[model samples]
Target: MESPATTKDTASRTQRPEGRPGYGQLLRTDGAWSFLLPGFLARQPYAMLTISIVLLVEHTTGSFGLAGAVSATAGIAMALLAPQSGKLADRFGQGAVLVPQVFLHALTIAALITVASTDAPLWSLFVAAVPAGATAPQISPMVRARWAARLQGSPLMTTAAAFESVTDEFTFVVGPVLATALCTGVHPAAGLIAEAAVSLVGGLIFAAQRRTQPASARAGDAPESARSDQARPQSALAVPGARVLVVAVLGIGMVFGGMQVSLTAFTESIGRPGINGLMYGAFAAGNMLAAVAVGAIRWKRGPQTRLLAGYPALVVAAALVAGTAQLDPWVLVLGALGTLTGLCIAPCMITSFTLIETLVPAGARTEAFTWLTGAIALGQATGSTVAGQLADRSGAGAGFLAPFAGTALALVVVLIFRKALHTPHSGLVAARGVGHRTTVTVD
Candidate 1:
């Protein structure tokens, strides 16, 4: 049924003479902009959630401790619930999962705002936060799933990985800054109000892109056996590779968490707390730049090979950062080291995502992505806690050890499970057999 000319065009798109597709080429795909634009907006609130919750709750209750506890509750809820949301999206469809969730999330935000504003019991803020966090759409993972669905076999999948990494970095860098500005400059509740608004509008638009969404295991369409299979419970963690990635990403999360707390401590110790953002910005800029560069290159090595190589590089980078923090502890020195550490982050992140695509079954791809997201979140939380304790007890730069420890743990896992990651080819076969359309990949 395939025409020669059409097939030729597909080949041209997938296997370019340059070997790697550029962002311009990747964006040229039909309907990409539709989901991408709204998805960008939809994902921003995730970054805003912590800062906004902290500011509004603190303003109302006049207690940073209470605000932190309430924010942690939301963070914990989101981390636990996101994978389940992804699983539902896998079964029922993204649109079906997202439509009600966006509205419910918006309503919960409203309720949370009301409770925070009123002289209500502190328990009500916690209660309002759970549903708000639980219902927030996991748009980043959903968009990545869309890219996988659209461009699985193509080299542009590589580009997509890079672009998503950059997008994620951009959102984290911008979102908190925006949220902080709104909370301080405008009103305490203004940041949260904006979060609710964008989440509602952007999530709805993202959900409306039905044509671009990945195929779900809907009941009527699939064979009875397949339907029965879907009925049975499945977790993405059932895949060993998924578990490995969770651990690896958890380490990456620790790196972020460690850096956040350690950097803050370092800045405050020097009495130049204002430059904290600039230091972190240097790190993020390196990550974004590296992601851009990595995506532009063509590689003969598979993701597994690249990942094995990248993780060690990350470990080394983290160690240097740790050493610099403990020894010299100068602003410029740490800034350069932070940038070096960030340069190492994107490749590993891009490869981890690429490997997950290779290794995960399509039926649970979104859930698998969410698991990694959740892992990073958990890692960050743990890293922050440990780093904060260290900063308090051992002085300023000692908190840097947390990131090194995290990277070392990840490296050990990757080296130990190197054999398990080679199952990508078999994973693809398994996914295809399960009624999901998947393309063969060289990796």
Candidate 2:
């Protein structure tokens, strides 16, 4: 629901004063807060839905193997289809792309539950999830693209990216908990049902904010000025830093995927598998805090520099985990290390995203972001596979080596392409955003 204050702000249609606004001011802009909040409502359940499905299937069929397979199918679908959905949004528009897809996703949610309830067939669930995921709106990209388009040529662009990272981390933190609660507390299907409803409503509202949508590319490639900044002619993939960034994100994904496995393995090895959530929560908490702080403060350095710096921090942290694996009883120490590592993780992700925005052409923004995410998913799959294999061979604690190895590889990639990351636009973006205060009102 829109807060009364947000409604009032939108109704008034005020603009930010002469200077750049802080995170608080940017959100206070007319329709901005209301527009931004719904993406969370819509996207959080996506994180939750996989676990919900797994739990539901496992509980009903008493087969974790089948449940894992079903859930993996949904994830694979998302990874494969996200870029296509994003391209449609760029070619058509966000509303045209998101509204119908989100609706279909909701229906698929219902159909999957009903079909599964009848014990129709395990393959039925897989079939339903293909459409569910294919139709799933790329809400996360839409949110980032909206902010990028709306704040183009402004300093808050970087801050907006940072804030988006914080939102993602926070949502992951909350999403699983909510799903577990709904599935366990009510019924297995309750969580999926709730997710469907929210995605429907929230996506509708989010897509309605047409002013923030990236401007449509012109027909027959009209002259540049005829289109908005978002409709530039340059190929998005051809953008200077974009390909390297994709490679970097893949490595980052591997690091994250390995960490999840090792953390779970660590807990299980110590005979307290349930404590994994608490430790992961601590990790997310650090990411959230660091992202917020990074967004609020004015950065003297550009994101290219920050991206170069971030990978090494993650490498160190991952190594620390492997080194400390023998201290099985010291969960607190491990958690603290996780949190410290996350501080580096969030900043690296936020900066890379910001740097990419600076490099992507206006017409290809959505696809560019989606492709990066998909690459990360691919990398994560690699990390997960390797970690699981290592665990089977050498026990869970040794699984920590996966993240450390992945991050070390990533650090090398970032260092190799560090210079190309600097762009003419890089310095201007953050400078325009910081050391100034202004009341914001969205266009």
Candidate 3:
């Protein structure tokens, strides 16, 4: 017979923590919010960077084509570097990877600003963007991977994901507005300088916090690590089905990237150059609302199946954006149109992420998610590159057609190649069951 004390101890050990923790649990269990702050600050600069560069370059060269080419080059560099950066983080740790990259990224921004101020060779302006993008920290992917890791298969993860999407859309929307204001009210170089400062401060703080970083594969800096490339498990990319999903993500990126240049030109064409960020914000607001709505209820369908709806929804959103081009600037019709499209933004992105999570093995969390970021950047680069030329020639309105075409192509891709999205029983259950209570709402 066990002693009373021993029996009591056994019960305490076996009993699990009580109650389901929804949104707030993540913060309470760990100081996640504390670290997320630095990550947010660091990421805000990314939104500022391209717009600031475009403004500076366009002002200096008096050519939107040159500006667009620079943005595209930087974006391409980011797309290629993102996955490699994630791989390093997974092998080493976040601190080692982030700290150095942040410093380098800051330096690159400072150099670009100097060139713009001094009226240095225009070629140098383009050169500066290369390092600016290559050194951009892998913060977003790291944060998402952390959430997925912490949440595991808990139903609350959907809420967490929705929250991430809402916050991200909000930041991207706000970042540009702030950038525009600084450039318009202050000096054009002010935005880039601000971005550098934010990146440095926020990144250092995040790196110092070692408690929350994802576990690395190796113990330390050793030639022979615990897992070698040859011995490692196959990556998420190895799954043939993942090809369609990644390509779809790439298409989405292109649309957003193209829209950025076109929207900037559109504001210029309308003689309200300051309104670019607000327009994007209006669209983002709709996205936030949708994310909130989705988080409130459980879905009856699998996440993969749910993704099919997003492609068409995006198509409608793009068409509406193009439609508003014909409306008078005084109509203020964009807010309603922007919000309408926002309704679909969260659903589309979150579903894609959830599907990726379901398909990828947990070990490759950071790398897999980072690839998503790369795809987005690549698409955006393509958009900005093409749209810049179109805007220079045909006008901003014609450039709006880029996003419409991109999204339309996205829809077609999913329709024809969507068979790969079929999830197994476990993935299906994860979406509908595990904490989801089936409640229907016309989504």
The predictions' CA RMSDs to the true structure, in order, are: 5.8, 6.7, 5.1
5: Cα error in model 2, Å: 27
Residue 297 in candidate 3 has what lDDT?
51
Tens digits of per-residue lDDT for model 1 on 1-443?
A: 44566456555544443433666777876678989999999999987876577668767875544565576567778889987888788789999999999899889999999999998888989899888778878899899889876764565665676678789988867776677668766888988899999999999999989888888876356445546766665677888888898899889888876776677567767887557667867777787788766665555566777788999999999999888887856789899999998899888887787678667776566567778889887776567556666766787788788889998988899899887787646433111111122334543
What TM value does model 1 have? 0.77
Which regions of candidate 1 are displaced past 4 Å? Answer: 1-22, 51-72, 110-129, 148-162, 183-191, 210-236, 265-274, 326-328, 361-364, 392-398, 424-443
What value does the lDDT take at residue 350 in candidate 2? 69
Candidate with better lDDT, 1 vs 3: 1
Candidate 3 differs from the real structure by a C-alpha RMSD in angstroms, to one decimal, of: 5.1
Decide which is better by TM-score, 1 or 3.
3
The candidates, ranked best first by lDDT, are: 1, 3, 2
Off by over 4 Å in 3: 1-18, 145-160, 220-230, 326-331, 426-443
Q: Tell me the whole-model lDDT of each prediction, alpha carbons only.
A: 0.76, 0.69, 0.70
**Candidate order by decreasing TM-score:** 3, 1, 2
Per-candidate clashes, comma-separated:
0, 5, 3
Q: Clash pairs of candidate 1? A: none
In the range 45-141, model 2's lDDT, one tens digit per residue, is 7666665665566567654445545665666677798877876776788888888888899998888788667778778978886676566667888
Best by TM-score: 3
